[model samples]
Target: MSNEHTTITESLAKVATRANELCNTVDAQIDNIKNTLKAEQDALQAKKTQFDAQAASSISQYQGKMDDFIESGDNRYQKALSKGDVIVPVNLKHLDDSKFYPVTLYHCKMLDVRVERYVHDDVSGGGILDYFVQLQNWSNGGDFTFAKQFHHSYSGRAFVGKISAASTPYTSSIWLRGGWSYKFYLNGHYSKGPVVIESETQVVERIASTDYFLAPITEVQPHVAANNFILGV
Candidate 1:
């Protein structure tokens, strides 16, 4: 009986030792699985950060390129057309004097408008104009009378030999240079008549430019108004 009890006790001790080893193995495997999951999570975070940085860089570059393209277009336009021209017949309509006239240039906002002149001449009914290279109105004066106004000193009185035009609805061109010299053309014909701007002083004093090249002219723009002024092109 003692011998049998010793053998059984020995067998029971070995079984317990095997069970402990299996539990230890299971615990180690669980720890390894947690470490592997942590590593994958860390890798994913790192990759996400890298992707975000790359996307931001690409967006910045695209914006920069767009800005450069717009600037380049402006430069090209300025170089091509030293003299500004607008087709008046394409852009005008007659309106009553009591109503306000509006002119838009280069898509810039005016926000507000104030009149500069209100001359009740026979033709334009009453002419209106703003000071400062923004357009004014004098369309009613017709061709001959309106042309006279361009060179006049704007003193509310008539002056002598006021740089007049031969006809109405004539095409006028101004060099619109830094010095403000202007040249005139009639109709579509570029080569027909003498380019009568009269004097450089007359051109510079009356015709002008803003900080920007193009100016605005309203529908009430005079047939007598310089051709460039008529179109505001």
Candidate 2:
């Protein structure tokens, strides 16, 4: 009976040792799995951060291009004028002739102007002024001749010329009026750019010594109001 009891006690001890070994193995496996999962999580987090950085950089570059397009008044994407391409006219009514009656009128207003040191397809050459002018009632009677005077505060001289054209929309880069030919690159000291352009217009009327002239002086002068465009660039 004592031998049987010893054998039973030894067997119980072996079983307990085996159970402890199994428990230790399970704990090691669990710890290894946890470590592997943590490593994978860290790697995924790093990849996400890299992707976010790349996306942010791309967004910033795209925004910069958009800003340039807005400032340049050109649309490279659509190859045409964008939504904000056209400049708003300072004075729209200066190109109209409803203010004057019974006599033909001549009018000119600057629609758009831009200045740059370097010439591009969209930009004129350096020291050059590209402008669009609007005319009204110029061809009502016949070929009419009118003088165009360009004045600027920076330029000491006024560019004056006689232009003859039928009534139509006018756009020209021929005459560098307003002394812009001399003052093109002179604005290097300015914070903006070497060239600064203001889109403004002035109009003058030519009076013939005839019945129409006397009619306005005697009769229409009282009823007619002079539609004047204050030079505001």
**In TM-score terms, which candidate is top?**
2
Where model 2 places Cα greater than 4 Å from the true spot, the runs are 74-233
**CA lDDT scores, all candidates in order:** 0.34, 0.34
**Candidate 2, residue 174: how far the Cα is off, in Å:** 20
Clashing pairs in 2: none
lDDT of 2 by residue, 1-233 (tens): 99999999999999999999999999999999999999999999999999999999999999998898788653453222122343221211222222211111223222112222113222243222222222222333344433232222211221212122222222122122332222121101111111112232222222453221201111223211122212444
Q: Write the per-residue lDDT of candidate 1 for residues 182-202, one digit (tens) a residue.
A: 122122222222222322232
Model 1: clashing residue pairs?
Answer: 123-140, 124-140, 124-141, 128-137, 129-136, 146-224, 147-224
Q: What is the lDDT of residue 186 in candidate 2?
A: 16
> Candidate 2: TM-score?
0.33
Superposing all C-alpha atoms, what RMSD in Å does each candidate have to the true structure? Answer: 17.0, 16.4
Per-candidate TM equals 0.31, 0.33
